[model samples]
Target: MRWEDIKRYQVIEALLLWEGKLNARQLMDYFETSRPTAQKYISEYKQLNPTGFEFVSQQRAHIANDDFTPQFIDLEFSSYHALFNTQGEHAVTSLVETLPQVHRNISPQLVRPILQAIRYQLRLDIGYISLSSPEFEDRIIQPHSLVFDGTRYHVRAFCEKNQDYRDFVLSRFSGEFAFEGEATFDEAHDTLWQTDVTLVVCPDHRLTELQKKVIAHDYQMTEQKLELKTRAALLKYLLQHLRLDIYQAAAEQQQIVIDPECRKLLAPYIN
Candidate 1:
């Protein structure tokens, strides 16, 4: 076997030892390897000791020894599961449908380690591709949590380079990921946490199904008006892409309404 393959083998072994024993679907995310590759690895590992491996088909989980069943931490699966594991299904299928197309790019392999890191607060050495740059940069980032906006998966990590917390879009990254060490941040995205947006929704638009859903889930609505309480940066992104028709005294106007705070922040875009 090649050195990289041997490392992959070792990594799988270590992960199984730590996780007790994971199912084929679980292994695909844990190792970022294909189902066939995971199966081959399992078969090879089982071959070494014929009596060591056991399968519980009903539970859809595996056990290393005949007497032991693996225990799992309760967790929620996101879009990454659908992208990587073909057999797996998401619980929130309706919510998934309303989301933007960017979320479909989430890779299952990218989700698990980051989740594990946040759970344990581990620092990771990753070859990350930044959104603004064409080159891949190697950096050690302290991962906190995964944020799922309607359209994409973001890894919120304390970037050593920026000396601040930043979000990395998972699908754009390509390379080996390594757990370097442990680190902590006083707050993740301090500026973002402090920022808020106020969305003044006109009464006529309040009855739309999409408006009702967005209001219910994302904002607080009061008497035909909604105020979106969210980060300013996020609101700016929404404003830039928003498609809506405006009516001023029966004259139809086509424009997207941005929060006042967002409009000032996005003044450069104003013409």
Candidate 2:
């Protein structure tokens, strides 16, 4: 098989292993592939997912054979150790906290389950508490991805009751899960837009040449000013990173002209 084919097969393997047994319809959506193509891969995957077996005939679905073992799993202990040190500055500290001395604070039990749900695209019914809202609320979410926010873990997912995509603080997901369901793949839910954020960076003339180099890449120098095009969601982050409040007429208006609904959705952050 070609490298691309091997990579595609790997995606299929990970999905099946993560989800346990995804139906043909779901598999088609997940892989963006035809039924025949997915079926061909599924036939091959059965031999691999040990527990995965074909349920052929009229009322057909994939089933786990007796020999099936959950080989597809979250990062193992060794894998966790290897990744811990290199993750970031807080990596060593977080690793240490996860040890027995601080076991309850960074609960390993909670960490593994949340990681598994993210890896497998599992739907989770969690009792979560927010700082703003002291009361714990029951939430049903289809976990889609993970984002590292420089510090703690954050899960990006589609919250069913909220009827929109939202980022949840992992630590706030404190209570026991009420229910966990196999995930149904979503295409539109995953196609996040590529956001473009523009900025005007006029490094003050008083600053030295090194200072100009420091702020150079994030901006473009004109005759006496700089214009920048960056991919970001919020203007605040751009302003903070550029470390300049310089403004220009064209730079202000050149922001992408997206749909009204999209603008409305982003207004709270962008404005």
Candidate 3:
């Protein structure tokens, strides 16, 4: 099958896995395929993985099995959010009444070169506007990976100017860039990206028992705490996104706080 067709099949599998169920009409609407084409994709998927889902006549949908496993996509929160946040007829029913969105100023011209550099392991000379500097500076970086931290896109790269690995915000980059020399660094040397840190978060102990319980339920915590594993480089952004950086806020006001033991590890990133 064509690569696009394969991707659509994977999307169907992902929708079923995350949303628990989906109908043919939803698939048709999302992929802009005809009814027969949608059915064909479903039929082919079912034939390949019989145990993945079961048809429910009452709901007129295919419900994912309890042991359903994703075939082509990683079960990442980003993937889940991307599928639901898309503006389309088959957008998944969201738990929240309204989804928050960030208006980014990223340009396709800037992103395309970064992606190409990453793919080819090349260096890029980019004009970047950093908060620390008042003016945009020309810097050479070896692009490695792209990340979306729920708000903006970031490119993790080895900066020749700083002599360290840093995240360059995609939108903050000026549209002027050129291909430099070959890349000197690889993903293996990125210590922050290679290290896995577990963030232990729990409802603030200052809150009442009832309030703590509510917070735990909202975060789907186990044993009153939630353990999230993330790259050390990305921990700072994650904490900021979850509003856990405001350590001075009252328990009731913040609702959640990081475990004292994990705070020391996150200090460098948080600061």
Candidate 4:
């Protein structure tokens, strides 16, 4: 099936799972398609998951089956919020554009089980690889949350072998996953993830006064600085996203850096 067709079909699956019902008219309004075309979307989805939904004559709609299982789309809520997931949301089809993204082929099979582990506080035995270990290394983790570090999907989990919480990239996982009963660590035990930190950003002082003013305005700064808060563990990702690395570019070109006072306080976390 074409990518566009799959996107349309996933929309049906999302509504059926989340809203508990699917009807041709509702699909018509959502996709701006005719009755027959909307029916075609439902038909195509039904073909993929035959027993996913059933018609409710009283409501004149296809009600989601109690055992409704998704054959397409990652049902994890984070998939909906990710900037690059684009599971069901179609992006601008015209002139508006964005930089090409790295395609992270994260399988729903990997995601669903991780989400289940997080929800139930269970441990998972997984085969994963990292830059240091090019081969898949068997490891056990107790995942607490799903994180999007601007580009890739990561599961923030407690690594049993490492004896610390770490972000494991979803695409790096391989082989089959096995649930390992209960997890000793959960979100509450992740001190860094539980704590919050503030970032104070300001335009480079070396820039001309006018340039500094423009930069401040661009970042919606007040009092010549932008103050923002985020999870302590996510500080590095936020810095990378804002391009605030002081050594990356010339002061004038970089435009912004964390305020010296805040930088001193946040140095340990960023490192």
Highest TM-score: which candidate? 3
The true-versus-predicted C-alpha distance at residue 240 of model 4, in Å, is 1.1
Give residue 111's error in model 1 in angstroms: 1.8
lDDT accuracy of residue 129 in candidate 4: 94
Q: Write the residue-wise lDDT of candidate 1 on 1-271 in tens digits.
A: 5765554444344334444565666556655679998787777656554564577887676666634321221122332234334323432122234333443455668666767778887888877776578788787888776666645667767888899877788776664588877776624455664466554543333246655455445434455355555564454334433432223442123222444564466454333
Q: Quick one: ranking by TM-score, best first? A: 3, 4, 1, 2
Query: What local lDDT score does residue 119 receive in model 1, on the 0 to 100 scale?
Result: 85
RMSD in angstroms, candidate 3? 4.0
Task: State each model's CA lDDT, in order.
Answer: 0.56, 0.54, 0.84, 0.82
Instruction: Summarize candidate 2's per-residue lDDT along 2-66 as a digit string, tens digits.
Output: 76655545444443343344456655654566999878876766666544555645546665454
What TM-score does candidate 1 reach? 0.45
Collision pairs in model 4:
none
Which 10 consecutive residues of model 1 have the lowest summed lDDT? 68-77
Q: Candidate 4 — number of clashing residue pairs?
A: 0
TM-score of each: 0.45, 0.41, 0.73, 0.67
Q: For model 4, how does the per-residue alpha-carbon lDDT over 96-197 read when each residue is reduced to its tens digit? A: 344576889688886888889999989999999999999998899999999897888888999999999998998888847899999999989999998999
Worst window of 10 by summed lDDT in candidate 4: 87-96
